[model samples]
Target: MSNTNSLTEHDHPSVLLPLLYESAGHLLSSAGALTGEQLRAASLLPGWTRAHVLVHLARGADSRVRLLTAARGGADLPQYPDESTREEEIRQGALRDADALRMDLETSLSGLLQAIGSHPDEAWDVPVRWLGGGRRPVRGVLWSLLRELEVHHVDLAASYTPADWPAAFTDRELRATVARLREDPAMPPVRISADGGTSDLSTSDRPGPLVRGAAAAILAWLTGRSDGAALTVDPPGALLPRVPAWRR
Candidate 1:
Protein backbone atom coordinates (compact mmCIF):
# COMPACT_ATOMS: atom_id res chain seq x y z
CA MET A 1 0.00 0.00 0.00
CA SER A 2 1.22 3.52 -0.77
CA ASN A 3 1.99 5.58 2.35
CA THR A 4 -0.21 8.48 1.23
CA ASN A 5 -2.98 6.18 0.15
CA SER A 6 -3.13 4.19 3.38
CA LEU A 7 -3.41 7.17 5.74
CA THR A 8 -6.23 9.57 5.07
CA GLU A 9 -7.67 12.51 7.03
CA HIS A 10 -10.82 10.63 7.89
CA ASP A 11 -9.11 7.65 9.51
CA HIS A 12 -7.69 9.77 12.32
CA PRO A 13 -7.02 7.85 15.56
CA SER A 14 -9.67 5.26 14.67
CA VAL A 15 -7.75 3.36 11.98
CA LEU A 16 -4.11 3.30 13.08
CA LEU A 17 -4.86 3.20 16.79
CA PRO A 18 -6.72 -0.08 16.55
CA LEU A 19 -4.08 -1.57 14.26
CA LEU A 20 -1.41 -0.65 16.81
CA TYR A 21 -3.40 -2.38 19.54
CA GLU A 22 -4.05 -5.46 17.39
CA SER A 23 -0.43 -5.77 16.24
CA ALA A 24 0.86 -5.61 19.81
CA GLY A 25 -1.75 -8.18 20.76
CA HIS A 26 -0.45 -10.54 18.09
CA LEU A 27 3.17 -10.07 19.22
CA LEU A 28 2.33 -10.63 22.88
CA SER A 29 0.29 -13.68 21.96
CA SER A 30 3.30 -15.03 20.11
CA ALA A 31 5.42 -14.41 23.19
CA GLY A 32 2.88 -16.28 25.26
CA ALA A 33 3.44 -19.39 23.14
CA LEU A 34 7.16 -19.46 23.87
CA THR A 35 8.51 -21.70 26.63
CA GLY A 36 9.95 -20.06 29.72
CA GLU A 37 13.42 -21.02 28.54
CA GLN A 38 12.67 -19.75 25.06
CA LEU A 39 11.46 -16.49 26.51
CA ARG A 40 14.93 -16.06 27.95
CA ALA A 41 16.56 -16.95 24.64
CA ALA A 42 18.74 -14.34 22.96
CA SER A 43 17.32 -12.24 20.11
CA LEU A 44 18.88 -10.63 17.02
CA LEU A 45 19.35 -7.31 18.81
CA PRO A 46 22.72 -7.30 20.49
CA GLY A 47 22.52 -8.35 24.17
CA TRP A 48 18.72 -8.58 24.31
CA THR A 49 16.46 -11.56 24.90
CA ARG A 50 12.86 -12.41 24.10
CA ALA A 51 11.82 -11.17 27.52
CA HIS A 52 13.82 -7.99 27.06
CA VAL A 53 12.16 -7.45 23.70
CA LEU A 54 8.67 -7.87 25.15
CA VAL A 55 9.45 -5.68 28.11
CA HIS A 56 10.79 -2.98 25.81
CA LEU A 57 7.61 -3.22 23.78
CA ALA A 58 5.51 -2.68 26.87
CA ARG A 59 7.69 0.16 28.07
CA GLY A 60 7.67 1.70 24.61
CA ALA A 61 3.88 1.64 24.60
CA ASP A 62 3.85 3.58 27.85
CA SER A 63 6.32 6.07 26.40
CA ARG A 64 4.07 6.59 23.42
CA VAL A 65 1.23 7.46 25.79
CA ARG A 66 3.41 10.14 27.33
CA LEU A 67 4.27 11.43 23.88
CA LEU A 68 0.59 11.59 22.92
CA THR A 69 -0.22 13.32 26.14
CA ALA A 70 2.47 15.90 25.49
CA ALA A 71 1.19 16.42 21.98
CA ARG A 72 -2.21 17.23 23.40
CA GLY A 73 -0.72 20.05 25.51
CA GLY A 74 -0.13 18.18 28.73
CA ALA A 75 2.86 19.32 30.77
CA ASP A 76 6.14 18.33 29.16
CA LEU A 77 6.62 14.58 29.29
CA PRO A 78 10.07 13.10 29.52
CA GLN A 79 11.70 12.64 26.18
CA TYR A 80 11.48 9.01 25.13
CA PRO A 81 14.13 7.50 27.36
CA ASP A 82 17.40 6.36 25.85
CA GLU A 83 18.01 2.76 24.79
CA SER A 84 20.35 2.01 27.72
CA THR A 85 17.69 2.83 30.30
CA ARG A 86 15.10 0.93 28.28
CA GLU A 87 17.21 -2.21 28.09
CA GLU A 88 18.19 -1.94 31.74
CA GLU A 89 14.56 -1.72 32.82
CA ILE A 90 13.72 -4.72 30.68
CA ARG A 91 16.73 -6.68 31.87
CA GLN A 92 15.97 -5.98 35.52
CA GLY A 93 12.21 -6.57 35.27
CA ALA A 94 12.30 -9.52 32.86
CA LEU A 95 13.91 -11.99 35.26
CA ARG A 96 10.58 -13.80 35.72
CA ASP A 97 8.89 -16.29 33.37
CA ALA A 98 7.23 -15.85 29.99
CA ASP A 99 3.85 -15.30 31.62
CA ALA A 100 5.11 -12.17 33.34
CA LEU A 101 6.39 -10.69 30.12
CA ARG A 102 3.12 -11.43 28.35
CA MET A 103 1.08 -9.86 31.13
CA ASP A 104 3.24 -6.73 31.18
CA LEU A 105 2.83 -6.30 27.44
CA GLU A 106 -0.93 -6.79 27.61
CA THR A 107 -1.30 -4.32 30.45
CA SER A 108 0.76 -1.66 28.70
CA LEU A 109 -1.11 -2.18 25.44
CA SER A 110 -4.43 -1.91 27.21
CA GLY A 111 -3.47 1.34 28.89
CA LEU A 112 -2.26 2.86 25.62
CA LEU A 113 -5.44 1.92 23.77
CA GLN A 114 -7.57 3.33 26.53
CA ALA A 115 -5.68 6.61 26.55
CA ILE A 116 -5.86 6.96 22.79
CA GLY A 117 -9.58 6.26 22.84
CA SER A 118 -10.14 8.96 25.41
CA HIS A 119 -8.61 11.76 23.31
CA PRO A 120 -11.00 14.36 21.84
CA ASP A 121 -11.04 14.84 18.09
CA GLU A 122 -9.29 18.15 18.41
CA ALA A 123 -6.43 16.44 20.12
CA TRP A 124 -5.65 15.02 16.72
CA ASP A 125 -4.88 18.58 15.62
CA VAL A 126 -2.06 19.09 18.08
CA PRO A 127 1.50 19.32 16.81
CA VAL A 128 4.23 17.13 18.21
CA ARG A 129 7.95 16.56 17.78
CA TRP A 130 8.73 13.07 16.60
CA LEU A 131 11.71 10.92 17.44
CA GLY A 132 14.78 11.98 15.42
CA GLY A 133 13.57 15.56 15.73
CA GLY A 134 10.81 16.39 13.29
CA ARG A 135 7.39 17.99 13.54
CA ARG A 136 4.45 15.72 12.83
CA PRO A 137 0.74 16.23 12.97
CA VAL A 138 -0.98 14.38 15.78
CA ARG A 139 -2.40 11.98 13.23
CA GLY A 140 1.15 11.38 12.08
CA VAL A 141 2.06 10.57 15.66
CA LEU A 142 -0.69 7.94 15.75
CA TRP A 143 0.52 6.51 12.47
CA SER A 144 4.07 6.55 13.82
CA LEU A 145 3.03 4.59 16.91
CA LEU A 146 1.30 2.06 14.70
CA ARG A 147 4.42 1.73 12.60
CA GLU A 148 6.50 1.20 15.75
CA LEU A 149 4.35 -1.65 17.00
CA GLU A 150 4.34 -3.35 13.62
CA VAL A 151 8.07 -2.92 12.92
CA HIS A 152 9.20 -3.99 16.40
CA HIS A 153 6.82 -6.89 16.19
CA VAL A 154 8.97 -8.03 13.31
CA ASP A 155 12.06 -7.08 15.24
CA LEU A 156 11.05 -9.67 17.79
CA ALA A 157 11.64 -12.06 14.87
CA ALA A 158 9.52 -14.56 16.74
CA SER A 159 7.00 -15.34 14.03
CA TYR A 160 7.39 -12.42 11.63
CA THR A 161 9.79 -10.91 9.11
CA PRO A 162 9.90 -7.90 6.82
CA ALA A 163 8.12 -10.11 4.30
CA ASP A 164 5.27 -10.63 6.75
CA TRP A 165 4.87 -6.98 7.70
CA PRO A 166 1.64 -5.37 6.55
CA ALA A 167 2.36 -3.51 3.29
CA ALA A 168 0.77 -0.30 4.57
CA PHE A 169 2.93 -0.41 7.66
CA THR A 170 6.17 -0.86 5.72
CA ASP A 171 5.29 1.84 3.26
CA ARG A 172 4.51 4.36 5.98
CA GLU A 173 7.67 3.64 7.90
CA LEU A 174 9.89 3.61 4.82
CA ARG A 175 8.63 6.99 3.72
CA ALA A 176 8.86 8.56 7.13
CA THR A 177 12.29 7.19 7.95
CA VAL A 178 13.59 8.31 4.57
CA ALA A 179 12.19 11.83 4.98
CA ARG A 180 13.75 12.13 8.39
CA LEU A 181 17.16 10.94 7.22
CA ARG A 182 17.07 13.37 4.33
CA GLU A 183 16.82 16.24 6.80
CA ASP A 184 19.65 15.08 9.03
CA PRO A 185 22.91 16.94 8.40
CA ALA A 186 24.99 14.15 9.82
CA MET A 187 23.77 11.56 7.32
CA PRO A 188 24.94 11.07 3.73
CA PRO A 189 23.51 12.25 0.44
CA VAL A 190 22.15 9.12 -1.23
CA ARG A 191 19.66 7.76 -3.71
CA ILE A 192 17.11 5.17 -2.54
CA SER A 193 14.87 2.72 -4.36
CA ALA A 194 11.91 0.70 -3.15
CA ASP A 195 8.58 -0.48 -4.49
CA GLY A 196 10.29 -0.12 -7.88
CA GLY A 197 10.87 3.63 -7.45
CA THR A 198 13.93 5.76 -6.70
CA SER A 199 14.37 8.90 -4.62
CA ASP A 200 17.45 11.14 -4.97
CA LEU A 201 18.48 12.33 -1.51
CA SER A 202 21.13 15.05 -1.50
CA THR A 203 21.51 18.59 -0.27
CA SER A 204 21.66 21.39 -2.82
CA ASP A 205 23.61 23.44 -0.32
CA ARG A 206 26.16 20.66 0.27
CA PRO A 207 26.48 19.09 -3.15
CA GLY A 208 28.40 15.83 -3.20
CA PRO A 209 28.42 12.40 -4.83
CA LEU A 210 25.22 10.32 -4.73
CA VAL A 211 24.73 7.03 -2.89
CA ARG A 212 22.31 4.70 -4.58
CA GLY A 213 20.39 1.71 -3.23
CA ALA A 214 16.94 0.23 -2.89
CA ALA A 215 14.82 2.66 -0.89
CA ALA A 216 13.71 -0.13 1.42
CA ALA A 217 17.28 -1.28 1.90
CA ILE A 218 18.45 2.29 2.42
CA LEU A 219 15.68 2.92 4.91
CA ALA A 220 16.55 -0.27 6.75
CA TRP A 221 20.24 0.61 6.73
CA LEU A 222 19.46 4.09 7.98
CA THR A 223 17.30 2.77 10.81
CA GLY A 224 20.38 0.73 11.88
CA ARG A 225 18.78 -2.64 11.17
CA SER A 226 17.20 -4.21 8.13
CA ASP A 227 16.82 -7.87 7.16
CA GLY A 228 17.23 -7.45 3.41
CA ALA A 229 20.56 -7.12 1.55
CA ALA A 230 19.56 -5.86 -1.88
CA LEU A 231 21.33 -2.50 -1.56
CA THR A 232 24.12 -1.74 -4.04
CA VAL A 233 25.82 1.56 -4.84
CA ASP A 234 28.09 2.64 -7.69
CA PRO A 235 31.55 4.23 -7.43
CA PRO A 236 31.38 3.32 -3.71
CA GLY A 237 33.81 6.14 -2.86
CA ALA A 238 31.07 8.55 -3.86
CA LEU A 239 29.23 7.65 -0.70
CA LEU A 240 32.17 7.13 1.66
CA PRO A 241 32.51 10.75 2.69
CA ARG A 242 28.83 11.28 3.44
CA VAL A 243 28.02 8.05 5.27
CA PRO A 244 26.95 8.86 8.79
CA ALA A 245 28.68 7.53 11.90
CA TRP A 246 25.47 5.75 12.75
CA ARG A 247 25.67 3.82 9.47
CA ARG A 248 29.32 2.95 9.94
Candidate 2:
Protein backbone atom coordinates (compact mmCIF):
# COMPACT_ATOMS: atom_id res chain seq x y z
CA MET A 1 0.00 0.00 0.00
CA SER A 2 3.02 2.23 0.36
CA ASN A 3 3.88 1.82 -3.28
CA THR A 4 2.65 4.02 -6.16
CA ASN A 5 2.30 3.59 -9.90
CA SER A 6 4.52 5.34 -12.41
CA LEU A 7 3.78 9.02 -13.00
CA THR A 8 1.15 9.81 -15.61
CA GLU A 9 -1.07 12.73 -16.49
CA HIS A 10 -3.39 11.48 -13.79
CA ASP A 11 -0.63 12.01 -11.22
CA HIS A 12 0.41 15.35 -12.59
CA PRO A 13 0.52 18.24 -10.13
CA SER A 14 -1.84 20.31 -12.27
CA VAL A 15 -4.56 17.71 -11.82
CA LEU A 16 -3.90 16.51 -8.26
CA LEU A 17 -3.05 19.90 -6.78
CA PRO A 18 -6.50 21.32 -7.43
CA LEU A 19 -8.18 18.22 -6.09
CA LEU A 20 -6.00 18.37 -3.00
CA TYR A 21 -7.01 21.98 -2.43
CA GLU A 22 -10.68 21.17 -2.75
CA SER A 23 -10.34 18.21 -0.39
CA ALA A 24 -8.45 20.28 2.16
CA GLY A 25 -11.09 23.00 1.94
CA HIS A 26 -13.86 20.55 2.65
CA LEU A 27 -11.91 19.00 5.53
CA LEU A 28 -11.18 22.43 6.97
CA SER A 29 -14.84 23.37 6.83
CA SER A 30 -15.71 20.17 8.63
CA ALA A 31 -13.00 20.74 11.23
CA GLY A 32 -14.09 24.33 11.78
CA ALA A 33 -17.67 23.21 12.37
CA LEU A 34 -16.70 20.81 15.13
CA THR A 35 -17.71 21.70 18.67
CA GLY A 36 -15.25 21.23 21.48
CA GLU A 37 -17.18 18.17 22.68
CA GLN A 38 -17.27 16.73 19.18
CA LEU A 39 -13.53 17.26 18.78
CA ARG A 40 -12.96 15.30 21.99
CA ALA A 41 -15.17 12.45 20.86
CA ALA A 42 -13.50 9.32 19.52
CA SER A 43 -12.95 9.06 15.76
CA LEU A 44 -13.46 6.08 13.46
CA LEU A 45 -9.82 5.22 14.02
CA PRO A 46 -9.28 3.17 17.13
CA GLY A 47 -8.12 5.10 20.21
CA TRP A 48 -7.98 8.34 18.24
CA THR A 49 -10.24 11.31 18.81
CA ARG A 50 -11.49 13.73 16.14
CA ALA A 51 -8.77 16.05 17.38
CA HIS A 52 -6.20 13.29 16.94
CA VAL A 53 -7.31 12.69 13.35
CA LEU A 54 -7.15 16.40 12.56
CA VAL A 55 -3.71 16.75 14.11
CA HIS A 56 -2.45 13.74 12.25
CA LEU A 57 -3.76 15.17 8.97
CA ALA A 58 -1.97 18.44 9.59
CA ARG A 59 1.27 16.73 10.51
CA GLY A 60 1.00 14.42 7.55
CA ALA A 61 0.88 17.43 5.23
CA ASP A 62 3.99 18.90 6.82
CA SER A 63 5.79 15.60 6.56
CA ARG A 64 5.05 15.36 2.85
CA VAL A 65 6.13 18.94 2.34
CA ARG A 66 9.44 18.07 3.94
CA LEU A 67 9.89 15.18 1.56
CA LEU A 68 9.16 17.41 -1.46
CA THR A 69 11.64 20.00 -0.22
CA ALA A 70 14.28 17.36 0.23
CA ALA A 71 13.65 16.03 -3.25
CA ARG A 72 14.00 19.49 -4.71
CA GLY A 73 17.25 19.98 -2.82
CA GLY A 74 18.65 16.69 -4.13
CA ALA A 75 18.65 15.21 -0.63
CA ASP A 76 16.74 12.12 0.44
CA LEU A 77 14.81 12.38 3.71
CA PRO A 78 12.19 10.28 5.41
CA GLN A 79 8.78 11.86 6.01
CA TYR A 80 9.57 11.89 9.71
CA PRO A 81 12.54 11.13 11.89
CA ASP A 82 10.82 8.02 13.24
CA GLU A 83 7.44 6.53 14.01
CA SER A 84 7.62 7.12 17.78
CA THR A 85 8.14 10.82 17.30
CA ARG A 86 5.28 10.96 14.82
CA GLU A 87 2.90 9.23 17.21
CA GLU A 88 3.99 11.39 20.13
CA GLU A 89 3.53 14.52 18.05
CA ILE A 90 -0.01 13.52 17.15
CA ARG A 91 -0.82 12.72 20.80
CA GLN A 92 0.48 16.04 22.00
CA GLY A 93 -1.13 18.05 19.22
CA ALA A 94 -4.48 16.43 19.89
CA LEU A 95 -4.66 18.09 23.28
CA ARG A 96 -5.01 21.56 21.77
CA ASP A 97 -8.29 23.46 21.81
CA ALA A 98 -10.61 23.06 18.84
CA ASP A 99 -9.82 26.51 17.41
CA ALA A 100 -6.07 25.92 17.50
CA LEU A 101 -6.40 22.48 15.97
CA ARG A 102 -8.55 23.79 13.12
CA MET A 103 -6.12 26.63 12.47
CA ASP A 104 -3.20 24.26 12.47
CA LEU A 105 -4.93 21.98 10.01
CA GLU A 106 -5.66 24.82 7.61
CA THR A 107 -2.19 26.33 7.88
CA SER A 108 -0.32 23.07 7.40
CA LEU A 109 -2.44 21.95 4.48
CA SER A 110 -2.21 25.33 2.77
CA GLY A 111 1.56 25.35 3.10
CA LEU A 112 1.84 21.84 1.79
CA LEU A 113 -0.36 22.61 -1.19
CA GLN A 114 1.71 25.69 -1.95
CA ALA A 115 4.87 23.63 -1.85
CA ILE A 116 3.37 21.07 -4.19
CA GLY A 117 2.19 23.79 -6.56
CA SER A 118 5.64 25.36 -6.71
CA HIS A 119 7.43 22.10 -7.45
CA PRO A 120 8.95 21.98 -10.94
CA ASP A 121 7.29 19.51 -13.29
CA GLU A 122 10.49 17.53 -13.78
CA ALA A 123 11.16 17.43 -10.03
CA TRP A 124 8.01 15.38 -9.58
CA ASP A 125 9.78 12.44 -11.23
CA VAL A 126 12.55 12.47 -8.62
CA PRO A 127 12.22 9.72 -6.08
CA VAL A 128 11.74 10.53 -2.39
CA ARG A 129 12.08 8.40 0.74
CA TRP A 130 8.94 7.74 2.73
CA LEU A 131 8.63 6.87 6.40
CA GLY A 132 8.35 3.12 5.89
CA GLY A 133 11.67 2.94 3.99
CA GLY A 134 9.83 3.06 0.68
CA ARG A 135 10.94 5.13 -2.29
CA ARG A 136 8.21 6.89 -4.28
CA PRO A 137 8.52 9.69 -6.74
CA VAL A 138 7.40 13.24 -5.87
CA ARG A 139 4.19 12.60 -7.83
CA GLY A 140 3.59 9.65 -5.54
CA VAL A 141 3.87 12.03 -2.62
CA LEU A 142 1.11 14.17 -4.16
CA TRP A 143 -1.10 11.14 -4.68
CA SER A 144 -0.42 10.04 -1.11
CA LEU A 145 -1.40 13.48 0.17
CA LEU A 146 -4.66 13.35 -1.79
CA ARG A 147 -5.35 9.89 -0.43
CA GLU A 148 -4.59 11.10 3.09
CA LEU A 149 -6.81 14.16 2.83
CA GLU A 150 -9.77 12.29 1.34
CA VAL A 151 -9.61 9.10 3.43
CA HIS A 152 -8.65 10.74 6.75
CA HIS A 153 -11.34 13.29 6.15
CA VAL A 154 -13.71 10.39 6.65
CA ASP A 155 -11.74 9.14 9.66
CA LEU A 156 -12.60 12.43 11.36
CA ALA A 157 -16.16 11.08 11.48
CA ALA A 158 -17.34 14.29 9.98
CA SER A 159 -19.74 14.79 7.08
CA TYR A 160 -17.27 13.26 4.65
CA THR A 161 -17.56 9.57 3.83
CA PRO A 162 -16.37 7.21 1.12
CA ALA A 163 -19.54 8.01 -0.81
CA ASP A 164 -18.54 11.64 -0.75
CA TRP A 165 -15.22 11.00 -2.50
CA PRO A 166 -14.90 12.29 -6.06
CA ALA A 167 -15.39 9.76 -8.85
CA ALA A 168 -11.80 10.06 -10.10
CA PHE A 169 -10.34 9.66 -6.63
CA THR A 170 -12.55 6.73 -5.76
CA ASP A 171 -11.73 4.92 -9.00
CA ARG A 172 -8.01 5.56 -8.66
CA GLU A 173 -8.05 4.52 -5.01
CA LEU A 174 -9.96 1.35 -5.79
CA ARG A 175 -7.37 0.48 -8.41
CA ALA A 176 -4.54 1.25 -6.01
CA THR A 177 -6.08 -0.79 -3.20
CA VAL A 178 -6.75 -3.66 -5.60
CA ALA A 179 -3.18 -3.59 -6.84
CA ARG A 180 -1.89 -3.69 -3.27
CA LEU A 181 -4.21 -6.46 -2.10
CA ARG A 182 -4.07 -8.61 -5.26
CA GLU A 183 -1.01 -10.53 -4.12
CA ASP A 184 -1.28 -9.98 -0.36
CA PRO A 185 -1.14 -13.36 1.35
CA ALA A 186 -3.45 -12.12 4.08
CA MET A 187 -6.18 -11.10 1.66
CA PRO A 188 -9.09 -13.43 1.09
CA PRO A 189 -9.34 -15.39 -2.15
CA VAL A 190 -12.33 -13.83 -3.87
CA ARG A 191 -13.36 -12.17 -7.10
CA ILE A 192 -14.15 -8.51 -6.51
CA SER A 193 -16.51 -7.01 -9.07
CA ALA A 194 -17.15 -3.29 -8.73
CA ASP A 195 -19.73 -1.17 -10.55
CA GLY A 196 -21.77 -4.19 -11.44
CA GLY A 197 -18.78 -5.99 -12.93
CA THR A 198 -17.31 -3.20 -15.03
CA SER A 199 -14.12 -3.56 -13.02
CA ASP A 200 -12.90 -6.91 -11.75
CA LEU A 201 -9.99 -8.39 -9.81
CA SER A 202 -9.46 -11.76 -8.21
CA THR A 203 -7.02 -12.73 -5.52
CA SER A 204 -6.75 -16.29 -6.72
CA ASP A 205 -6.80 -18.12 -10.04
CA ARG A 206 -9.57 -20.42 -8.91
CA PRO A 207 -13.02 -18.97 -8.45
CA GLY A 208 -14.06 -18.25 -4.90
CA PRO A 209 -16.84 -15.90 -3.98
CA LEU A 210 -17.86 -13.16 -6.40
CA VAL A 211 -18.24 -10.03 -4.29
CA ARG A 212 -20.03 -7.25 -6.09
CA GLY A 213 -20.84 -3.66 -5.13
CA ALA A 214 -20.44 -0.01 -6.06
CA ALA A 215 -16.86 1.18 -6.46
CA ALA A 216 -16.93 3.42 -3.41
CA ALA A 217 -18.63 0.80 -1.32
CA ILE A 218 -16.06 -1.77 -2.42
CA LEU A 219 -13.21 0.63 -1.65
CA ALA A 220 -14.68 1.41 1.74
CA TRP A 221 -15.00 -2.26 2.56
CA LEU A 222 -11.51 -3.03 1.32
CA THR A 223 -9.99 -0.14 3.28
CA GLY A 224 -11.73 -1.20 6.54
CA ARG A 225 -13.85 1.95 6.54
CA SER A 226 -16.99 -0.13 6.50
CA ASP A 227 -18.30 -3.65 6.94
CA GLY A 228 -19.04 -5.51 3.72
CA ALA A 229 -22.77 -5.21 4.34
CA ALA A 230 -23.21 -3.21 1.13
CA LEU A 231 -21.52 -5.90 -0.93
CA THR A 232 -23.24 -9.07 -2.12
CA VAL A 233 -21.63 -12.50 -2.32
CA ASP A 234 -22.40 -14.54 -5.41
CA PRO A 235 -23.63 -17.58 -3.51
CA PRO A 236 -26.97 -16.94 -1.87
CA GLY A 237 -26.52 -16.46 1.88
CA ALA A 238 -22.74 -16.87 1.51
CA LEU A 239 -20.75 -15.05 4.12
CA LEU A 240 -18.48 -12.25 3.05
CA PRO A 241 -14.83 -13.19 3.10
CA ARG A 242 -12.95 -11.80 6.06
CA VAL A 243 -10.17 -9.44 5.11
CA PRO A 244 -7.14 -8.47 7.15
CA ALA A 245 -6.67 -4.92 8.38
CA TRP A 246 -6.20 -2.41 5.55
CA ARG A 247 -2.58 -1.41 4.96
CA ARG A 248 -3.41 1.95 3.28
Identify the candidate with maximal TM-score: 2
Per-residue lDDT over 1-248 for candidate 1, one digit per residue giving the tens place of the 0 to 100 score = 11232336535777666677677677767777888887778765777777777787788778767767887775556435555665677778778777777888889888888878887777665555544444445555566557666656666668776566665565656666656666677765555545454445443345545445555455556565563345655556333334443320
The C-alpha stretches of model 1 lying farther than 4 A from their native spots are: 1-11, 67-88, 127-141, 196-218, 232-248
In model 2, the Cα lDDT at residue 99 comes to 88
- Where does candidate 2 stray beyond 4 Å? 196-198
Q: What is the C-alpha lDDT of each candidate?
A: 0.63, 0.85
- The candidate 2 region of ten consecutive residues with least summed lDDT is 1-10
Clashes of each: 2, 0
TM-score of each: 0.73, 0.95
Best by lDDT: 2
- lDDT tens readout by residue for model 2, 1-248: 45465777778888887898898889999998999999999999989999999999989999989888988998877888888999999999999998899989999999998998898877877888878777777677788888888888889888788999988889878877877777788887888888843468777776789989898998898888989898899988888877778642
